[model samples]
Target: MADKDPASVQTDESTGQPEKSAQELVLVSEVLPDRIPVMPVYPRPVFPHFMLPLTFSGEKFLEIIREAIEKHNGLLGLVMISELNEQNYLASGLHTVGTVARIYRCSQVSEESVQIVVQGLQRFERVRVAVREEPVQLWEVRYHYDDRAVSVEELKPHILAIMASVKELLSVNPLLQEQLKALLQQVSYERPHMLVDLVSSVLTAEPAKLQDLLETFDMRKRCEKLLLLLKQEIEVFQMQDKIHKQIGEKVGRQQKEYFLREQLKAIKKELGLEKDDKTQEIEKFEERLKNLDVPRDVLDVIREEIDKLKMIDTHSPEYHVSRNYLNELTLLPWGVYSKDNININRARKILNSDHYGLDDVKERILEFISTIIKKGSVSGSIICLQGPAGRGQNLGRPLNCQCPRT
Candidate 1:
């Protein structure tokens, strides 16, 4: 496998100097170690012609990796962890199909940690576990080649279909378009297998699904899988874009309504319409308060409510509720007092005239009127004339008797 200059550079942590660039070519004819130290990577599978950055901790693990870098020319096997448990990695428990990675750059992160950038060289399958213990986890791996028996002519249609899907993806997914365009410029249709590997690495898919594509050696089958993934990605992007546009339109309409309402308010103020209405309403409330002699505490509350109403938006429901409360408050008879004008004989005569054969009810009302006259007020007292419906209750006879309005 060969590639141009890598897209990223890793700097040494201690020395603060850039590492050597991985611009050299690696041919298939070059010697590769059959047994190599294997490291477990997680979440994503590495594809050939792709670079993955990995972090390692523990002094023993770092030392083992350092020995592999020194003795094996930085060549190692990286396999994805089937389970996410970190303990599984220490036991050399990983998927069999993995990539043969070459260390492109290494950096000392700290005393117990190291970071390395590796470029996948080829697809490899673990033949056997050579060593599985602390500080040493080696695997005997065999490299596999992409099916080359099929000529380029046989893959032209597949290649075209993938490119078309990529184009569709480019139109919907602008965030990844730059990287996709860069990859497109680097890849050629002649190397359909390489294109499939490199392109599939960047596209979004499940790790297991990507691993399945990575293990697929047949060029035609890999192309088919890659095309399907690209189409699915396009669909996801399209759906996401549709949801975003709907949210944007709804927000835009609300903003437009708010803006128009504000503009209308400004126009009305300019024409002396809105300000005059608000001022007139406030003046009417104040006038009512003056006529009724509202209590000082209640006056303060009503004034505060009016102030709040002024600050609130006229189109808001709170404004109307506040205004109605203030109107009711100002209209109440806050300081109005009732006079003790009751006469027991006059009430008895009025009740006797209003109804017949209700002597007991008339007697009770006369006694209540006498109590009011004695107390000088009807405070802490209620006079309820109870009787059956349609009976001569004579609720209006008290008015004729000149009962004080309590």
Candidate 2:
């Protein structure tokens, strides 16, 4: 085709389908070649009529771009790279179908890399890759077009379906509205394939799906496929919007609880509490219990109740009940005590001043103290002062001259 005369271009003016310009016809001949340099990249396959820039920092890729532009008038094919490591992908991940992009502009970004704006001009299928020991390779490709055609009248239904789906998608996802509007302008009323490329350019699916769209040659089927994809996107966007709204509603309902919790936490923190009042209270209890002279069995009971207090929410009604239990526990004489030594003579004088009768009781109390002094260790015993209320009832006051108990 390169040696032959340019193919005659034809179109109808009424449908606004202009004939291919002489410049475009010449570009077409370049793609018919049996061998072309293929740029294997990780980007989504570029559809025809869409333009994007490629940045190449590697000297090899930059040289390839320069050779394609300077030596062959920017004739190159871009295949999608499917592997994570671009080194291996350059050799094995090359997809057979790719776009022929023309580098219309190139800029020297730095000594290491260059940036080039390449517009996808056509879709081509790789017939074979020219295997060589060199890092970069060329491909023998043929220009392929889906010859299966559908009339404009037949494509109207699918196009309308796509329009409705886009509108629905925009309702839930208005962020892309302006971009969609700009892309929609690319839709050609006469050519369904133009609409396919225009819509598919902005609609993001996986790179594989977009690649599938670019490789498709059946113009009408492409539009149908896009419509289905757009509808699926709409459903997904709607569901996401619904879940977001539901979560918002849940947060709204819990606003009071959240506010209360934060306020409580802030107040407790100001008072040197780390979590909540109950938690701080429990921590204080634990710290005190450590230095406290509590019996082992009683300490275990106190710790178990403290754990229960921790499990109870600060907002619960039973929190006070547990708090009351802790208060009762603190009421016990934790470390208080009395000395065993007592002055028998001072006790006899206090008995004479505080009491009138019960001379036998006074004599017996003196005798008991003398006995306790001689014994040196107290044996548990109950001492009762008899007679009237004022006689010797207060005599038990001095009995606590021993260890205090809860």
When superposed on Cα atoms, how far off is each prediction in RMSD? 11.0, 15.1
Instruction: Report lDDT (CA) for all predictions.
Output: 0.78, 0.73
Instruction: State the displacement of the C-alpha of residue 132, model 1, in Å, after optimal TM-score superposition.
Output: 0.4
Top-TM-score candidate index: 1
Model 2: lowest-lDDT 10 consecutive positions = 1-10
List, residue by residue over 1-406, the lDDT tens digit for candidate 1.
Answer: 2222233345788999766545323455455778888877778888988877889988776977887788778987878878776564565447889988889898999988999999888888888988776767888877775655687899999999998988898899888889878877887998887788878988888888898988887788889989888988999999999999999999999999999998998899899777645666788888887777777888889989888877887778987898888877876677775543476666667767777876787777778778877877767977664576533334545644323232
Least lDDT summed over 10 consecutive residues: which range in candidate 1?
A: 1-10
Output candidate 2 Cα RMSD. Answer: 15.1
Off by more than 4 A, model 1: 1-29, 57-64, 86-93, 110-112, 275-288, 295-332, 339-406
Off by over 4 Å in 2: 2-34, 83-87, 131-133, 146-149, 260-335, 338-406
